[model samples]
Target: MDFKYDVIVIGAGHAGCEAAVAAANLGSKTCLITMDMNKVAQMSCNPAVGGIAKGQIVREIDALGGYMGLITDKTAIQFRLLNRSKGPAMWSPRAQCDRNKFIWAWREVLENTPNLSIWQDTVKEIIVENGEIIGLTTFWDVTFYAKCVVITAGTFLNGLMHVGKTQLPGGRMAEPPSLQLTESIVKNGIRSGRMKTGTPVRIDGRSVDFELMSTQDGENDFHKFSFMNDGTQHLKQLQCWTCYTNEEVHQVLREGLAESPLFNGQIQSIGPRYCPSIETKIVTFPDKEQHQLFLEPEGETTQELYLNGFSSSLPLEIQIAALKKIPAFRNLEIYRPGYAIEYDFFDPTQLKHSLESKVIKNLFFAGQVNGTTGYEEAGGQGLIAGINAHINCHGGEPFVLARDEAYIGVLIDDLVTKGVDEPYRMFTSRAEYRILLRMDDADMRLTEKAWKLGLVKEDRYELMKSKREAIKRIIEFTKDYSIKTALINDALEFLGTTPMKYGCKLIDLINRPQITIDNIANYVPAFKQMLDEIEENRKEEIIEAAEIQIKYQGYIERERMIANKLARLETIKIRGKFDYDSIHSLSTEARQKLIKVDPETIAQASRIPGVSPSDINVLLVLSGR
Candidate 1:
């Protein structure tokens, strides 16, 4: 059998779903091929979405007209803004999703989308001709032709799961591994490496002693992921419980560490440094006598609880022994044993900013296939790759987000510039301009760009424009209106804020650390009425933007100037064939690495590990920029 499509996206996980939708929504004849249609967008590890820097990626995806935020909002059982007490830059939106519902919603959305088709089959080999990827052949001997191919085959490329000494050739639990794709890519000269990740054992919620552990609940004031569901009601949330491990738990793990796959050479791939498993953490941080274990509810209806921060690949008997030592899990019934899985991922440095392979034209990669870890990171990258693939096929300029512009920009830039050795996880610290990339204004910053490229709908663009106008009006109102001590003295004193010595604009007063726009709205009925009419997301957005403007005005402007300077460097484009070896002024290491990577921009070149400021200055002098 033979089929033709404009774009072919392999694997229907978060990355593949976003890629397919992005391409299809852009009017490409896109086909999503997955091994199991029933497991499309499956949350293989965790059932939660967004946290810290990852939340910003989700917001960026929403702004780019991707469906993740919408599906997350639709299926979320609980929502909260993490780091609420911190600055606006640190505040990130997170949600606990019903896993089954999340995947179902994804399938429903994909099925309803125009120009997108779903195929239930495993991709066996990529068909490349003259170093250009043309299509792929499935295991069943079906050949599908495409102008561009995106591989988001997350954790399924020769995937192998390990539980102590027992090993299975599966992607997750029961899913079969793709047999020949890894070999096919290697034959094409694309470099690949092994990476391992693990998930924690789940316990039946009915067997756990919730009374003995502290309950972790969502905030009283809820915040959903999508701008579309700001005011709508979602499902009622289930509570999560927290417990801690004592010395006995550590002892049990230590006694069995000799048999662990991660430590005993059964697995050689590097795992994520931030989200280490129980055995790794115990061995690495031995000074800490206890580790916290969270019992997160899998769904509102299911009695299964996800054991967060307890990921392990130790023997089953040892896992049981360790759990029995925990205060709240003395009589815990085991549901599933945690295991580690190793899979093949490409070296993302081989890809251009468009995520298209430099070695193979029209071939792209996303998700864990590119060595990224989180659902949001994969989704964000997939959306970019999908959009760019569609654009490339149309003879349009590639969509590239810069470091200072958005978190997605930072993510891609970092991946292409400085390739990660371990599973790459997003954190706010990774972005130098996190203040400018606030979650509050993701749509404001990126939607217009996406809309102009025909990725976002007209109505969504209009909504973003309207939001900008409202935010402008609110900022002007606060700037123009002054509050006299005579009017606000009592309320201010009652709230323990310093009473105004002289009259000041309400906006200026709101810049105070303790004061907020919401606090003053209650004092003025007109302010309350004005806000009540706006969309809740937009309202929060306006308030947050106002607060940031007032508080970090100088810092933001300084960063903007710095970004502007860096943008000038980005304007000077270089080819991948630039012979850095010919530049005698550069250091030997810098010259060698530059010759090997062949960075496209001076900005990217400067970010290479061994490249120095003097070398960049030499490049500027040589390029006459």
Candidate 2:
């Protein structure tokens, strides 16, 4: 049988799901092919979504009309805003979700999406004709044709799972690996390498002693990810527990070193540095007495608990023995032992900024296939790839984000510019223009762009515009409104700040480190009256945004100026057909790297590792800049 689609997305993980949705939403006939329909958007590692930089990516995904944030909000069992005490730029919103519900939510959305369809089949080979992707052939000998293809195979391409000396051919724990796809792609001249990631053991929570652990609850206030007010609120929140692994636990785990695949040199790929296995942590930090472990609930309705921070590839017997040493886990009943899986990942440097393959026309890669570790990173890449695929197919201009614009931009830039030697993970520190790319205002930054691209819905777009106008009004009011000395002195004294002798604009008071809009609203009748006039639903968002804008006015302006200056380099486009090999004036290393990456702009070229300042100057001269 033959199936035809404008876009074909392989693998129904986070990346594939977003890619399919984005393409379909843009009116492209998209087919999402996965090995197992039941595992669509499955949380293979953890039940929770968003953390630190990952949380920011989720918001950006939502801002750009992606479904991840909305689905997460609908199924989230607990929500927390991380780094709230710090600056607004550092603030990130995270949600611990009901794993089953999260996947079902995604499935429901995809099923209802107008131009999208789901198929259960294992892809065997990408059908390339005349150096361009034309379609794919599945293992069952069924063929599907498409103008563009997105491969988000994740950790399933030639996957190998290890637990002690025992090894199995599996994508994750029980899922079968994609054996033929990686070989076919590699044979087609696309470079590939191996990287590993692991998941912790699942414990029967009913058997564990809660009294022996410290409880950590979610925030009391209501918060969500989608900007459109999805009406899905977390009515009853679940609490996570914390425990620690002592010297005894470490010693028992060390005893299994001889049989461990990681230590035995049976598994040789580099894993994530930030999320190290328990054995790696012990070996790396020998001086530490104990390591903290978070006992996360897999779902509110299930008794399974995800033992986070205890990811391992050790012997099953040793794992059980070590768990018996911890106080809270003394009577632990594990649902399954932890294991590490190593799989094929292409070097992301082979892709363009839009995630399209530089070697293969109409082929794109996202998620773990591109060497990124988190669901948020994968979803972000998937969205871009899907949009670009649709645009390319329909004769529209390709969409790309700048470094100063969004975290998604930083992620792609880092990958294509500097190739990863290990599993790549997003961090707030990675983005230089994070001050301007805060999670609080992602909708303001990307919704208009998404709307213009036909991705954002009209209702969501309208909400975003209204919110932006409200924030602007509040900021302008603060700039013009002044509080009298008599009215503000008591509030200032209460806040432990020196009382002002004269009247001052509200913006001036807001600029002070200790003062906030909420604080001023409590004492000033005029300010309170203005706030009262605004709708209750929008008041909190307006005040929060207004406060950040006022407090960091100078820093934000400086960053914008720097961003604008760097953005000029992006305007200098590099011709696609330009022959770098013919440019003899360029250095040998620069020529080789530039030829390999074939960067789209002077800004991107400048970021390439071996391309020096001298090389950039030569390019400028060659381009007659």
Q: Pick by lDDT: which candidate is best?
A: 2
84-150 per-residue lDDT for model 2 (tens digits) = 8998899898988999888889999989999999999999999988889999999899999999999
Q: Give TM per candidate.
A: 0.97, 0.98
Task: List candidate 2 segments past 4 Å from native.
Answer: 575-587
Write one digit per residue (lDDT tens) for candidate 1, span 1-625: 8999999999999999999999999999999999998999999988999999888899899998998999888888878889988878898988888989888899999999999999999999999999999999998999999999999999999999999999999999988998899999889989999999999998987788788999888764645666655566667877877889999999999999999999999998999999999999999999899998888878879988899999999988888899989878888897789989999999988989999999999999999999999999999999999999899788888999988888998888888888889999999999999889988878888999999999988989998888887777777778888787898888888777889899998777777776778888788666677778777655776666666777788888998898898888898887753578888889998998787667888889999999999999988887886
Q: What is the lDDT of residue 104 in candidate 2?
A: 88
Off by over 4 Å in 1: 220-222, 522-538
